[model samples]
Target: MELNQLISVNFNLRKPKSSTPTPLYMVVYYVDDKGMKVQAKIPTGKKVHPSLWDSKRQQPIMINKGIDLTTNQLSEQAEVTAYITNCRILVYSEKNLNFDEIKEKINLKENNEMSPVTQQFISAKKTPKATKAMEVVLNSINESNKSENTKYAYRKNYNKWCEWLRDTKQVDSMKALSQLKFNEFKKWLVASGATNAMVNDTCGYIVRIIKEIVNGEGAIYGVKEVTFKKLATTSTNVKCELLEEEIEALKDTKTISEREEFYKNVFLLQLATGQRISDTYTIIKGEYDVLKDDNGNEFIIIKNKKSTRGAKVKKSYIPMTKEVSDLLQVLQGNELIPTNDKTLTEYVNIEIKEIARRAGLNRITPNGNPLYSEISSHYARHTVTTQLSRKGLTSEQIALQLGNSKEMVERVYKHETDSDIIAKLQPAAANTPAPQVQAPAQPAVAKDKDLEYYNNLSDDDKLLYTKKLNDYNVLKDDFFKSLERQPERKRKAAAEAKTREIVQVWGFEGANDMEYKKLCFFLDLIKQDINDLILTYKVYNDEAPQGGMISAINDYERLLINIGKLTYYCHL
Candidate 1:
């Protein structure tokens, strides 16, 4: 029988009380290997008014008395829906399990939402290995130099991972950190509908934490190695930033409540300082000086919350621009924001979007949504980076202001339009086309010495270097085309040949040293191209290209790994 035919699920109200809420139960029916029909009745630990549940749909009805659901009502419905879907996935994915085992798994997952006393009782029953592993992970997180908010996040995710291990894999926590179980965990996350960015961070943190554990005390955990491959980073939302006018509008806007005013101030401060929402708490809560140099240039030094553990410079020097100075003046001697960091961040995220929406900042996002809907505390960092670049600050200077690496600023924060780039170059050569070398009518060996080293190249030579880079990119494009079309038998050889041709054109064979200018420049140029390729492949996979999607995704993952390596080496 087909998998879907083998397993079926539906919901039932236990008491079917008309006027009040009642417990919800899910019934799973499946046929065992011996062809015995079996049923597992699992309580969802959620309740809804019997009238609100649609028996046919096994979902909560959204309407009563010709009215739309309230926000809280909608949230409760969503939670119930999520629970139902999760139960279905569990039943279908584990069809091989007998009725009793399936019931046990569902019960375990459901217990996560049970009362505090029940949850504690269930937790106490976990294996000693699981408890020890949790201890190691939590202790390591708390003892680390990561910010309090970051530690909180890590601990929360680690607990979820542990719960997942217990419920789904039915294993000790130490085993979940093993390579095989970690891969399963990734699959589970994807199945659970986690966004790409969420899966990336959640999995990435777990991998890092485990490595920290093994590196610190290898004997405590049973696993000798943890080599979990992380997923490619994908933009999960439209890239957006506020305009100068929008910032002004936010400044001019009136707030009805102290809370709204407080959130608005926090957001504006984020824009002025380019700090993470978490780091901004440090700036506000602590006593920091806005000092001046001998030249009377005002600046504030911020110890970046997320900087490397042993970096030489933990502080970023933010030059006090008018925006920063004005905000500081407004906030001076005022009572500090009366909220914790997490609540402050959440409130700011909500209020800032509403404020932008009300101000009529209706710019369309790249994904065709209104830009105001995409505004968040993090967009302030992007705005600051782009603004600094437009104002002609060097990359190094912008990095100092943002307290991040130049490569990171370029890769993540900077979002310039093509027109902006063209405008920046217009003063130098507005009308000049990209310099190109004349191709001989006959195929000829490309000269290696015609070009000076990239660093010493003249303007014309710089353009020619770009032209050569384009030539390499063109070869890469051709390689992908060929890879897409080649017969399965010859695809491997075709891929190797095309890749070698591309690399050979770029002349990366001999310049492998750190001091090699050509190698560094070449890597930097292709990093963006590789990123584009990953995104393109993602789209192609979604469209289910004629070439196997698995193959495309595999290639995409490989490109992701290579780019990660290249970025690392470039930074070195």
Candidate 2:
């Protein structure tokens, strides 16, 4: 029974003489703790039934007569040893013995007094205090009127913390709940692999339990008020906005037959309405108003379900662009948004990550985790408001569309229109061709060596040089065409065209193709050029023919140039 003694114990089933074939298990032990070879036998036959000692309720239970200690069972040995050491220390302290002296005395007892050691060993076998605390915590949590998911999470985390506390702190007395000890417990909790947020939550739960105990509630417990240090908030920079290229990539992702149509419709709706996954799922066809304003300007009243219960909830009035209406038409007859929120959010997040990965926008954190420089679905609202604000919508106007207050609009939507206007002006300057620099008067006495150096190249070298120059020109042409095809470029072109119309009305000539090209580049400087163009011209009240003319001209020129360059390159 001594902490240092070695023994082997085993349980055997036996029947009593009076018992009618009722089987029971008996535990036998061999002790070497006192250096006196001794054996103890205890009968755990059916004659003794398990009982709840405090409540006098009979229950079936296994009796622990003794434990066999071996080096192979190191964990079990450690547990038994800790219990014995804690008990001996408590007894020795009460007797006013020096701590080290008490340890030495206990170590000496390995040679004598085997019965007292056995008694102490048996006493320590009682159920742990944490087990009781856990029961109380679980019972309280179950009885509370919390959400099922919340309750489940609380139980799981509470059990985890209890296990960690038992193992690390070796808590026994209720007095250990003091603030200092609680701090130590928290430190151990963090060290035991719990995250900062998890640690905070677990500590919060523990505080609640302690409060109940201190206030004389059921299974009252007390601990010193624990003051936990706040963990630093982990800020993430996730890009939530769907760029034109990113949207294309998502659309291009291959889908299975089972989910192909569903996935496509879901993504398209997100792009069109910028609705969060939760709101997107509940959007019904009737909730949308397809009527036009007094000026014949079409708009959609997106009746928010969260706000429809007459509880002063925010609601948004999104203008139904042709693109959004078309998508809704495609998605008709679906009771839900065709996908669950988690699945849709996860898919979009994965796609966003892949886009960032492909675009070389992935950044590394100090801890070596990949940090994305964008937001997630949670930031979709902010991105929508910012995008709308850049289109010359006032804060009040955006607030009305976003179902938020103007104060919130100004506070959250930080995209500045003035900055966008300045960005738009850059292309105009670039397109205004610099005065053709006049060549310096040619020197009559040019060096003959320089002229000969250029003239002495071989036919093969000349051909290679000419081909390289042509390839360079072809690449330049393709690059510029891509810029022209960009949506932002179209917006810039339309804005410039509007400016040119004003100039024309005052007898000024419209910009030539070169000026228009410059405007395209300027428009490309803005984010989400294509979507912005669609919003600005197509959504707003610009004449279709005029708007179409500008977009079509740019598209046609780009196609022709690209085709011509490809043909010339192939022939070369």
Candidate 3:
């Protein structure tokens, strides 16, 4: 099955950078091709010290503060492990599990409302041997007919692993990868400041590559089994769908900057089609792709490039609304809001938050973060699926529209809301008995106990609490800022050095004249992105606004291409 059609589950610290104990939250996000988001955070209700969490494992490390784990820490670690296991079952299971059902199972086990699930371990046997890096790469490529995008992601990750292990971990041989200390490898990857998701995906690539080598012809060197638990990057709530009023406001906006207007139009286009980032960019200046039916109706028919390479080729057709049809007419000569996926994603994410905030969609998350905190380009797909679901489209119909299976659509695409549940509580017929109670609301992050107490305090006490909270945030920001120190090098020198490194490692040595220019062209995109960041963040006097630094890093991730997929394999 295509990954985009399924939900993604991860674990993360509730307040990772905060210098306080925070509960772990499980984050689930995925596009429900029918235009609904399966994104949500499931709280584990178990807290751990900020330092003890492990990025690659998404589970806590057994050791703490350079010492063996304490009894309490060990208990929390087990709970985290089980929470992840159960979450995986829910997300990956054949049975469709909704958020409430998943939450109920976990809560029931926790509150002793239901019996605990017996944990099961399924082990795979494998023989790993000495393997040549390039040989394994070739085997991985030839053995599977995955999409270029998927292969690029894996190959790029493999490239990073080769660099880090050879440089930092001091591995003597990539050929003997299984002999290396896997835990140490994970530690170095985490310490390099990768987010939980980044580290997890990269490590996952490492394991897959190594396993493939062993399973192929590389089993001559030694016998070994490879295994890992996927990392969890959790979040509690999402800024789900935009309210109809908010959508209408964007449609009716009169006063806005040109750039904002551009993004707003793109956002509307996204909602109309509900395509993934890569697929949406397939849109270019074209009336050619738009077609007329026998009955004189119009529909968009685009090739779905995001699917697996071996999947039967098919065109996705979206019947055009008058709105979509008109939007396409206006998009004729002008560049789409984002020239590429990188800029497009960044531009949409940043603008939507402001748009939603300005349009009065500022519902606060229970965790005290802005509801808009995690809103991004992908939210558009969720918005579309949600609107369709509410319109009473069947799962099969929604799946066909979105190019996914009905089971997945039904599993991840949600039409229900709190209001829906409330409506069900009303009597449908006079003869029918009304249920005594509605389903209990989904569990929410508890308000901070101390803050709750402070609110109940006298006015003078409340004033003191605000002062203290500000001081805490100030100190925390300072510490996070300290963690972001740049190396001591001039920008020109650094850029030159980076170019040299990229060329040396990423595949430029054998580049013919044409290939060389393509590599140069790619590098220029990064340079432009960096320059744009300088202007956008106004990093004057070498001072980095923490927010800008973070936003820029994420945007850069979108742009960082794996040219290695071409350069490394072209000659071979």
Candidate 4:
């Protein structure tokens, strides 16, 4: 249907059963595919009676009889025009348009325009009215260029909060996101099946959005409508990691499907590397992923994908163990787990839990509980972190091992046990050097006596001896480096030999006096040409008259070539 030629819209007053104001109803008329005239009715959701409705214009008359644009009543009439325009757009659309899509378009446009920041500068007389925190959040989503995953997380968490709020009928708008009510919301989220971490993350996103509104640095929210304090919802530690034996069992257990096996290998690699599922599952064994140290040892280097805007991305090189190297070899020239992260997580979790069951490593606690209550993709990380912690690795070291921040290791990875200080106090290894029987050289000490004395020294004395060892090593390196160079006498001899070869090649031994005189004349001319060329360039540019320095240089080169021929002729 040609919308411009055939389509038209008309508005009719909706008659209420009683004598009361009712919204205008829209009717769209166009020819159908079968060449029959058709009409569709859609509600404008704007209240107007028979007297106010303009049937010919098919638009509602100004809702306000007054001539003021600033009046709230005029705003309502503007909204009616907005609705009518939305219907006209739908009627003119080339594609078959649905009511839902039209409604969504209107809502999206309204939400975009409904920002407090946009309204703030419009009217300075009145303080900006606070909207819902959700509105601010939705606006941020529309404006944000964050990664899809981060945006999804923000929207998902906000939706969950919205669901809870709608049930309680609290915090339905930005004006209600006050600190006191927020505390109630936070408590409600926690009580309503949200784990502490979930509640913290969900509430934290809300708090951050609220703070952005108050700061007015980016998108502004309405002026503070209600006083509120920040929520204290820091993420709590989650203590579910695999033990050594459990990890071993997971390795030993086998799967039946290639897909399951793919996830299993992915899990093993993640466990070994402590990489996130995003990095681990889609690993490609290419040259860029492999790093070789100065000593030529190879490592797999990975940079995490979870970095904040303007933050330095976390990256680490994990030394390739035999198992990891073998795994890479198997996955060589192929993507090990070529699938989405969501599917990879499901396969890994399912196969890993089954593997644990088969190995009878499900639980081994004093209370007869399993090592992990639920095995998920993150278990690989938690397992690696906890095991490294048990091996006496520091938070910084663990963070590097897992490609994460030290604060993360301190908070989430560490499962430290009580230690006895006495156990750490042990005798240092004997520093006594092996005896050397040769006579003492100059600047040397008695080897046997010195070694014996060093062995009996205290910690401070031992530190001094260690420094001496370091100095000796440095001296040894310098001595070895010196071996690559020649002495001054040999260098001078080599220079003289080079000069002899040059003179012999010039035919000085065979040239007659006349030929030598001719060569000297050419050399003098070439030298003079060089002098003139340099003077010409220094005094003036090539554009100056008689300033052909480049041509003079070319002539000098031709003379030098002739001199070389003369030397060869003299040899003949």
Q: Model 1: residues >4 Å from true position, as ranges?
A: 1-235, 332-339, 427-572
Error of 4 at 211 (Å): 46
lDDT of 3 by residue, 179-269 (tens): 3455566777777645465567777877777777667544544424467676677566443666665576556543245667676777788
TM-score of 2: 0.34
In terms of TM-score, which candidate is strongest? 1
Off by over 4 Å in 4: 1-237, 282-288, 332-336, 364-369, 419-572
Residue 552 error for model 2, in Å? 53
Worst 10 residues of 4 by lDDT: 441-450
Clashes of each: 0, 13, 14, 5
Query: What TM-score goes with each of the models?
Result: 0.35, 0.34, 0.33, 0.32
User: Model-by-model lDDT, in order?
Assistant: 0.67, 0.48, 0.57, 0.56
Residues 1-572, candidate 1: write the lDDT tens digits. 32324557888999876688899988877665667676767786679988778888888877667758755477678878776777677666664665656556566643433222344446555424644655677786798796655775676578657656655635465555677777777887877645455567678778777776677553444555566665665355756667886787677656655656777888898988888887777777754567899989998887787778777656678778887667766655567464566766766776786677555566777755566666789989899898878767778889987888989888888888787787776665553445548753321112234423565767676666666777886786787777778766666577657655665676555225333446545555555455445544543343444545346435644654553465466556
Question: Model 1, poorest ten-residue lDDT window?
Answer: 442-451
* Least well predicted 10-residue stretch by lDDT in candidate 2: 49-58
- Give a tens-digit lDDT track for model 2, residues 402-498: 6667886777543445766675567655534456497543211112223342245576755554554354345434444554555654654544444
Off by over 4 Å in 3: 1-239, 253-255, 336-339, 365-368, 418-572
